[model samples]
Target: LGIGGVRLLRALGLNPQVFHMNEGHSAFLGLERVRELVAEGYAFPVALELARAGALFTTHTPVPAGHDAFPLDLVERYLGGFWEKMGTDREGFLALGLEEKPWGKVFSMSNLALRTSAQAGGVSRLHGEVSREMFHHLWPELLREEVPIGHITNGVHTWTFLHPRLRRHYAEVFGPDWLRHPEDPATWRVEGLGEEFWRIHRDLRAELVREVRSRLYEQRRRNGESPSRLRQAERVLDPEALTIGFARRFATYKRAVLLFKDPERLLRILQGPYPVQFVFAGKAHPKDEPGKAYLQELVAKIKEFGLEDRMVVLEDYDMYLARVLVHGSDVWLNTPRRPMEASGTSGMKAALNGVLNLSVLDGWWAEAYNGKNGFAIGDERVYENEEAQDVADAQALYDVLEGEVLPLFYAKGPEGYSSGWLSMVHESLRTVGPRFSAARMVREYLALYQKGQEWAGKARGEQEVLRAFHQALPAFYGLALRVEVPGDLTLNGEPLRARAYLEGEVPKVLRPFLEVQLVVCRA
Candidate 1:
């Protein structure tokens, strides 16, 4: 499909200067480009070099299974003739997707994409570091921190996701320029909200409650529930309750059932005088029966614990439901295991609508959390085991809910208003609204595209250099180099030295092939 996509674009007379492959799924585009270059009278190796210069790839998955791979026989069956047309033999083409292990029959799409792209990146800062370690095999001579991948944190489309009510309010306060400058904190103008803001906020909550009740009643009716039970949906959730929303793709690493780890403790918190309510919605993959079973268990616990009115998971989650939850909920919850989430963007949508985030510091939360703008789940600690991590995170959730979240939320001042909670809401809106919008993301991409185009143009202009480098590829294949750091290494505002031991068909003046990085760590 990826190869066909490139062909289709060419048929339409589209000459893309930079090929941005969002993931390995479309990595075949790189191969197609090389084939095109070969047809234009370039040698196979030189074609690969030029094609790589014009390619950029972004990796979004940290887990191994998230990557796509295929059997060698399958690749040959599909692409054998295609490679043959480019004057490349079977083994040479197969080597493009080679795995490092002894059992190397499978071809990794990610490996092929990494080798072919001139630039690569992860979706967030932490994910960039994680990606470097994950793909360091491609650059064995470089230090871990010196791996080439960078990051551009994910963002949300503010106008598409922001509530209409909030949009109107923002426009009134900051003028129509707010729409164009949604990433600017000054454009939000939280101070201008005044008393009318809370009134409208209450109305938004009431509207969300009505929307959920209507959807739930219809779902139950279709499922053959009693009419009496269906009617009870009208009183499902309180509009004024401290609502915490947890919604995303139903993956186990997200730990959707983390709060239910201790039912008794969760019950205690929910049964308080100023009780809290939760809104949960997500869909498991079609083949993910275990995820579906977890969802069923969660719903059963809600009923068995007699907390139906305080919690509900809407059916067939969609964009409309996401808008309702982000706009109406008082708090947005995300609990992905550390370093597993690439760049979760739902919480950014929630924060844009003045919803406070209570999330584990992973993905974008690692960069966004400021101790006051949002609540943290746990300290940045990597536990030795999954069970230990779950226990610690659950306890931290309970502690924050009881000690900080609930207290501030239910602390009514004048006319039943929690000024402290409102202050946090304002801060979240002010800080995150501008920083995590699609406008900023597009600008960053444009800057990177300019850089990529310049690099590709240089490579295209210097064909002789590319031909020379291609000729050197075989000698560089199995070369090994060792480095030794000085014994008295220190960073007390002084220089450090290291010696390299290169042993192979070596190239003199090896400055182009060698790089040095000094790593500093606390004792």
Candidate 2:
């Protein structure tokens, strides 16, 4: 996959200066790049160095099991002829990924990528720290903080997750270029549109209810259930009810069953004065027995407590259902074991559509939550044991639902919408919209790519003179100029008049180098 991807790029008449490996799965690209340089008459070591200088690797998982590793014999069997092209012996090639585990030595793909990349990072700030400690052995002499691993938190594409109605509303208020400036907080100052916003959200929620009912009915028919059971599926949830959504990979550490820790308390909330319902949709790995067991336990509890109407587990969770849930749900629920979640992006998607997040203080939530936007399950405290942590988090979850989330949601006004709840929706949009957008993420990555290019140029001895010139410049260098428009210009093909004023001292020789022009943008 790695070699084919690089070759495909070359076939398109493109030669990228920077190679970004999303995870260790693509580490083989580094070897393929080195081989290209070798074929061009460069020595193996020099080729490897040049390839490494322009490569960036981003590690996504904090758990060891999540990373890919293979037996030494397996690697040799598959890559036997490949290493000959790079002018490296079998032992030398294997040493790039060699790691001594308790069972035996294995070839870790993550290790290979780390060895071959010039820059490496984790997906979030907390993940970065955890990664440094996890891989500290690779740089034993350096302090944990001094380890070279940086962080660029994951983000979701705003338009992909945003509801079309909301998108239109934003375009109407903030203009068509609103998405172009999604990272700017000023672009999301949603106010006085509370009634319309609630109406759009409720409409989406109604559509979601229809979709869920249809899916549930079909599922019962496939299982050969009774007509009465199929009919009950249609009436499973209330469209007016406050809905909480949970959807992601049902990994054990994600603690999907944490909400069921105290079934009696949960039942009370479900049967309380205000209506509430939960919509769960996710799939566990086929090999993960424990995760499957958690799913089974959740289904069993829904039947055992006879709360199927108030709670549901949607089958076949796909991107379509994900969009429905994120767009329609009132709250996004996440309960991962502390520090186990590297950086989850599901909540970010939900938040983009104004769904409040009720999550444990882990992953992206650890940095995004500001008390007003969403509710936290528990404080950022990790217990010594798993049992204790689970118990505390479950209780905290119930407390917040009963004490805060429920009351605010049900507190409606003359406009037939909860003003307080809409305030939170506004805050969630204003805060999460800008900071956790793919637009911002791509910009941050571009900066890293530029740095990688500079490093790669240095490795090839092409940037020494440029580096010295940059270093020789004064701290207070370059021009500080502002443009002023004295009069309003009509759009009747009239040329606009503007003046440029330089605010800082400049050398006489540099005067001719400065030129200013007026740039106009059509709205």
Residue pairs in candidate 2 whose N, alpha carbon or C atoms collide under 3 angstroms: none
Cα error, residue 443 of model 1, in Å, equals 1.0
TM-score (all chains, Cα) for each model: 0.93, 0.85
lDDT of 2 by residue, 1-523 (tens): 3888899999999899899997756998988998898797766677777888899999999888888999999998988888889877888788888888999999999998998898999988888988998888888867787788998998899888999999997787778888888888888877745777788999999988998999999988999999999999999999999999999988889988898899899889888898999999999999999999989988998889998898889889999999999999999999999889999999999998889999999988999999999999999998989999999999999999999999999899988888999999888888999999998899999999999999887877843443343343452266577778777667677776778877776654444544555545578
Error of 1 at 517 (Å): 6.0
The C-alpha stretches of model 2 lying farther than 4 A from their native spots are: 462-523
lDDT by residue (tens digit), candidate 1, 1-523: 3788999998999888888887666999888988999999888888887888888888999876788888889988888788876668888888788776566668889888987888899999989989999988878878888889998988889998888887888788768778887767668777776566677777877888888899999889889999888988877998888889998888788888899888888988887766789989999888988888878878888888898899998898998898899888888999988879998999999887778899998999999999999899998887879999999999999989988999998898886668888888888888888888888888887888888898889888988777777677667656876888778557688776778776776543343766545565678
How many backbone clashes are present in model 2? 0
Question: lDDT of candidate 1?
Answer: 0.84
**In model 1, what are the clashing residue pairs, if there are any?**
183-434
